[model samples]
Target: MTATAPLPDTAGLRSRFDAELANFLDRQDPDWPDGAPRGVFRTLHRFVLAGGKRLRPLFCYWGWRGAGGADGTPIVVAAAALELFHAFALIHDDIMDGSERRRGEPSVHQLFADLHARSAWRGDAGSYGRNTALLCGDLCAAWSDQMFHECGLSTDEVHQGYRIFSLMRTEVIAGQYLDLVSGVGDGSVASALTVIRMKAARYTVTRPLQIGAALAGAGADLMTALAAFGDPLGDAFQLRDDVLGVFGDPAVTGKSILDDLREGKRTVMMALARDSADRNQALRIKTLFGNPGLDADGAAELREIIVATGALDRIEQMIRVRTEAALAALEQAPVVPEAREVLAALAAEAVDRRL
Candidate 1:
């Protein structure tokens, strides 16, 4: 993440929101009965608080403000609920990717493993840790709902928002399955495009925008415009993420590049490389994936191959094209100036960020 220059004072707006989020998280810490295994609630709380852009909450706020709604504690709670859902996703994602860090600290699984080893928990420490983290992720999912439950949205609005969220999860998981399945079979352009739309594009940008717009009682036409805007912005965001996953500074991204490459993610970059590679190129790529000692030199070679295949150029082209489309949508939308300015800034950051 770049050091953003100081801009407007949002302290008054942010403090109240932070309080609500913190309070909901606190409720997750129901005291354990004596002699029972302790829950990892506090640890999880720390994990969520470590760092994030708070993008969901910010969107919720801006959307509400755009609708001329009063900003208050309840609105803040509703906004914070969106982030809790993200926490649920991240915990599981870390486990799936076998990642060791989050927000520059040891990930939940790793932390549990270390605890097991140091405190001498019964059973295999590593196995125990994995199970604990998995459960913790499940717990986070439940806690997210609890946070949403506390939001003061009308029943109908809350139901609508949740419906969008439910669809969001299904789409994302389907995308994940597509990513996993692509590994076993030959890659196809059609399937790749489907996964891209379902996985990164919809959830990260489009749905969030829709959820907010719908909550604010936006008309169908406005919602349609928001969706169009989100598609390109979301694509740009994901493409930027893919680039960062491979080549970004670890200090900025808070995770090792090695994990993603080793996981053999069926990214657009990888899929394109496969499409363009010759027989010899195919054989080379097949060999290097998932080798534990696929070192820096090997990683660099793989990267070179990906770029040399002209896939990188295509991916870069797609980013530019989609970003332009998103900008055009924004230009056409009847968004107010204050919300428009922030959204514009966010769109630029989504594509142009170093991390």
Candidate 2:
């Protein structure tokens, strides 16, 4: 099987982690302070390449390929930049969410904090860890900017990519604010949908693909096709995330169970639960969500109630429907079949993963 193969299937793109990432890391260090180690680069590299879906890069590549771009080198490097950017976001996200793990491993900040605790850092160990990780996250973000600029794409394309990245940053930050507020009961489902579109769906899936298409010199028509397909597919992506946030395994997913509930996230599941439930059920939800003190049995009971109320089944159906809709959108798209393979596999497998 090639590197970009489908889940539980054979054959895929060349694994960009080793060769491509090594080259990317070379550009990161002009010089290292003796004995300090390239701690930042090493840690960021591990985090970025940590057994992941490589979804952003793959989305970017397939987007370019779908648009008939011959310049694979530029796109691959550009795609790598996307993954770097995602790592930057996730580092900060784990910090904000107080999430202990990522992709079934210690979150960068948590890892640093744990190390600091063991080694007797000067200040508070957790603070030391958080601050260090924050700096590293910024460094990684800067490296992404440098990578895209130096990826050998046209000047115009590079500038356009920067512009999109800027827009994405602004939009996702706003979306995150809305999401945070919504969890506290100050926002509505409409707002949650908006957040979903701006934050998770677009950056995680849609925009990366669009970036690839743009780099490929796709015309307005193809851009429209991509946008048309990106919106709903992105929604499905976030929806699955919501499901996983509630139901996924801690070990396999590398995130704590009921994380979204504990965080009081305004997911589609939460929204549906609120709308369909009785006042008692709603009170239970409100009381349980984001309660860090809630025990495992309490969480399990909540999950049971959610399932017994048919909410879990309802959410599953939504996933299935959204999955079909994404497939249909792809069918309607005017792209080469081979190019579609990676994306279709990603979309399907994102939801199909055991976690």
Candidate 3:
């Protein structure tokens, strides 16, 4: 591979994105009485400004640049809008997955739950937290749409991009629903791959790239080329996430290693394990895989089973293959040289992560 240049001032780009988000939040006035209700927006402000990888916006930004779009406020605002959509996804995902932590802090719902309990509020604290977080997620989604539309792009440009953005939303929701059902249904590798493709692959990479390309008036051919480069990379990204969820340090990943095991997340790795386990191993897996009270010891045993069955090795190989495919496609993609280099670097960072 050719030596890739260092990515553009990513810190600078992140600072600008943060400023846009802050400015947007500052403009929001709930017009409600002061109390916990008003605090909702405050919490949202903190959540929005909180730390994130900002991968979607970076991808979108580069996508715009690759398609001959200039570096300007319009693209930055439009790209940053993706972060709001990402926040919306994460808040709701944490709620659905019953996750308590995010970015090394209490999840949006858990933050609200803790507040309710601390204040000795009436009713169920858990319910209140989930409800409030749902509203927050909804607000983020709405704000994402508003920001994208008001991103100072031409009317035609905004209109062109909205179609892809709208479709991306629908696809992600559908993917989430599929994930919900797949957990309870037969846990097949095919089912897991479907979930990954819909939930992570397209949503995380393909659509974001396409949306930026569309905003820059890219044609069908370039759109197809971006998908070719994005889809495999996105798959590898999710596969790495599944590995981290099971084997990563909580301190580094900002998530409990046992959560996926406890939640019975039917990942491709787990499916592979189940498929290859011996009878005794299968019995052990069936007994302990989804137990909500699973402790560290049980998690260790599950990890052993996964390793013994070669699931971890298989997943590692899959990630490697998909990443290679993505890079190869990117090399052949009809994009500018700067985008090609930055995107190659981004792909490596996205999949080759300890966190």
Which candidate ranks first by TM-score, i.e. highest?
A: 3
TM-score of each: 0.89, 0.90, 0.96
Question: lDDT tens string, model 1, 1-355?
Answer: 1112223334544565567778877765565446656657767778767767676666666655544455556667877777777777787777877888887788888888899899987889778778888887777777777777668888877776677677877887787777678766666656666667887788777777767666666667867877788888887788878877887889998978877778776677788888899887888788775666678887787788888899889888989999999988888876565666777767886788876
**After superposition, candidate 2 runs with Cα above 4 Å error:** 1-14, 33-37
Q: Per-residue alpha-carbon lDDT of model 2 for 107-198, expressed as tens digits?
A: 89999999888988677978877888898889778878888888888898777666766776777777777677776664455677787988
Estimate candidate 3's RMSD in Å: 3.1
lDDT of candidate model 1 versus the reference: 0.74
lDDT of each: 0.74, 0.74, 0.91
Clashing pairs in 1: none
Q: Please, what are the lDDT tens digits per residue for candidate 3 over residues 17-134?
A: 8998888777776544456557678888898898888889988988888787778888889999999999999999999999899988999999999999999999999999999999
**lDDT of the structure predicted as candidate 3:** 0.91
1 versus 2: better TM-score goes to: 2
Q: Sorted on lDDT, highest at the top, how do the candidates line up? A: 3, 2, 1
